[model samples]
Target: MPVTDITTDPQSLTMTLTAEFPAPVERVWKAFTDPSQLERFWGPPGWPATFGDIDLTVGARVQYRMTSPRGERSSGSWEFLSIDEPRSFEVIDSFVTDDGEPLDGFPAMRMTFEFHETPEGARLVNTTYFDNADALEQVVAMGAIEGSRMAMAQLDAVLQDLREYAEGKGTRVELLDDTHVRITRLVNGPRELVWRAHHEPDLIRQWMLGPDGWEMTECVATTTVGESYRNSWAPVGDAEGEPFGFEGEVLLVDAPRRAVTTERMQGMPTETLNDLNLYEEDGATLVTVLIEYPDKETRDMILATGMADGMESSFQRLEREVLTAARP
Candidate 1:
């Protein structure tokens, strides 16, 4: 697929995605279980993922190395948390730094993979748990969005392969003014599901994030027009963490794949984000999120905060998930 080279501030963050697959439960399950099959699709794409010694049992240890185009090797290990043959599994995924030192940052990602049978094929659901908001924020700030979008772009990148796929459409930052920055993306799910993704408390826990150790204490959004709601997002170990993010509000909710605006009480200003989900030629639905910030500060803040790179990266990640979930 055509890759999107996402660049970011490495501090402010972006990228959040979710997808559904049309393939069977058993097939999708194997893609995760069998190292060989998983390796075929995993990694940064166009890059190499060398699956070394892999042991799939629970509490088992495995070492895998991924080499970038520059031939730099990054190694990570996986510890199985829970596993059900051809069903579901969970694991704590982390990277091992050179000199054998354990790096305690971004690589410390946890994931829960699930496979469910459907009339046509199977449903694959991957819920990635964060170590804390800091890592989540860092990755978001770094290149999560661009990375995922690049991965998802692979779908159109390759046409002959019959495999899984996912995507989180590009965001629209309608330069609202000199003080605000508008941002939005299209999600490939029903309006209810998409709405729930942003509004539901339990669902928000899985996708929203903050600084490495920070966790969202609460996200209460009122899905109504003119009825405002507040969301409390902060560092885990320290609720009142630095760069306090005690903010967030919903201005309008256009049910079934559409939201009008958003506001950050103290951190950032307000924006009108129009999120839309539509269909493509091949029967796949495409999502489009359009946002308009209130003024120049927000716009400048977003740009200065590495908005372009971060948004691009988030798009890439969403692309990856979309391709994976869209596969039949």
Candidate 2:
């Protein structure tokens, strides 16, 4: 219902959709940038979406899939071209195979989303440029226009309740698939500080501790793409639990924004890929960690160990001890 106009211009080889929302541009922008909120309305009615490997930075690629009521699935991807926080972003959108490659015979399109404040609230102008008139006609014939309308129609509810969706939610976890899990927490700190706390050994020792009475005995942190890092912790002063540690090699690094690593318990042969992403809005940073397990059994075993609860403790400590003290 938020959609006010939908137009296709053959001469321009483009399709555009305009919609208005009763929310500020910042809130509207978050709904699109945050994978959690984006997934809620990105898919049409019965077809819900699940996003994976989402990094909103320019040059990053995001993969997602929409599942139909009858269990049919369609995969897609976005290659980010540009981003101007809270205002606009552009991406190359394409229908992709399960492996994330563009499907044969399906042409990719350039899509730009612009957000502007209006007297009523905010307005979004989304335009998609096809390679040719034939491409535009092809998409329209395949229900692109109708699908977009239905998708945008669901945005109103998302915008209306975004606060309830994000605020005060401590460390939260979502089982993305049989082998993937996403954990998110909104830390009361800026992205730069959060990123530093993650990479700086001294700062990390202060808050990365899960519970009281545990101390990080070893903190060998690294940011180099090919470098390996290790962390070890031991309980102190009658505290229970054995000393344990994790080791991993950095796979990707985008300073203050995103990082990916292969992590595993020390001496364990199995490893999981961890993708960490940070996004800041209005001073508070949203930390999202996507973990890919080797299999469903490993995924279940890890979750059963109350991993999210321990992470919640660490996040709380991070804000209470490190972030608050660092702020002016």
Candidate 3:
């Protein structure tokens, strides 16, 4: 039988998961706040991590594009709210891909994670609220529990890393917790040049390619959210890419900041909600992307694959293009 923590009540459904980490409260807290530390431990089993424009703080937002073991990428957002050092924090997580591109209908989640102090270590709690009984039952029936256990197994690996590195050659730890997959980059060039790179479809075309051989051979984005578009590409060499490769539907577009929210397929075709933002820092503009996968497994896969490294590499490519294409 599958293990789902969700329980049925009268009107709505609730899911709660609890786990204890064999580490001091303070160190655990640091892992939660620091972007670098958090990245090390954020995925499910068999998936490592790939981060994107990661800037974490109160009201500070970041984006992530992760790839699973099966070569699938999923994206999502983290809108931060409360920050109590390493004790607790809150955020409204949207499981969306860069595309609004469509996988049935999933609403955003308001999740509150609390940390409690224990004599041996610390206890972490995850609580989620569902709209109705049916929704609660529907998701629970969809392998939520089994998926969470796998994610926690991954978390254990993260804690071990922390004990090995941060806590120094000093602590022995084991972290057990379960949760769903609710899941980096840089760019160069002057402000104006960066701005132009994003505005022009021709320039955007140069670096948004997937893997090495996958290219966006065909895309039909009509501008802004609400509007929809499709992109198709084929893999190069011997790699047999995911089943589908036609996706990317606009969700939100912030022109001034050059930020956009989208629903994209699994780097293939399956609606995943996601968002991307381009910002100017000093004289150069930095682009950050976030993706939300629909399941724990998908999220874990994307994270473990070094999505951030891939995006940064793509941006480097974009930066060179901008410098080369700028009015010289």
Q: What 10-residue stretch in candidate 1 is worst by lDDT?
A: 157-166
How big is the positional error of residue 267 in model 2, measured in Å on the Cα after superposition?
Answer: 0.7
On TM-score, the candidate that comes out on top is 2
- Would you list the C-alpha lDDT of every candidate in the order shown? 0.51, 0.85, 0.54
Which has the better lDDT: candidate 2, or candidate 3? 2
Q: Model 3, residue 111: displacement in angstroms?
A: 0.9
Order by TM-score, highest first: 2, 3, 1
The deviation in Å at residue 129 for candidate 3 is: 2.0
Residue 32, candidate 1: alpha-carbon lDDT = 59
Best by lDDT: 2
Cα lDDT, model 1, residue 255: 59
Ranking by lDDT: 2, 3, 1
The positional error of residue 266 in candidate 2, measured at the CA in angstroms, is 0.2
Worst 10 residues of 3 by lDDT: 167-176
TM-score of each: 0.41, 0.60, 0.44
lDDT of prediction 2? 0.85
After superposition, the stretches of candidate 1 with alpha carbons farther than 4 Å from their true spots are 1-17, 98-101, 104-107, 149-328
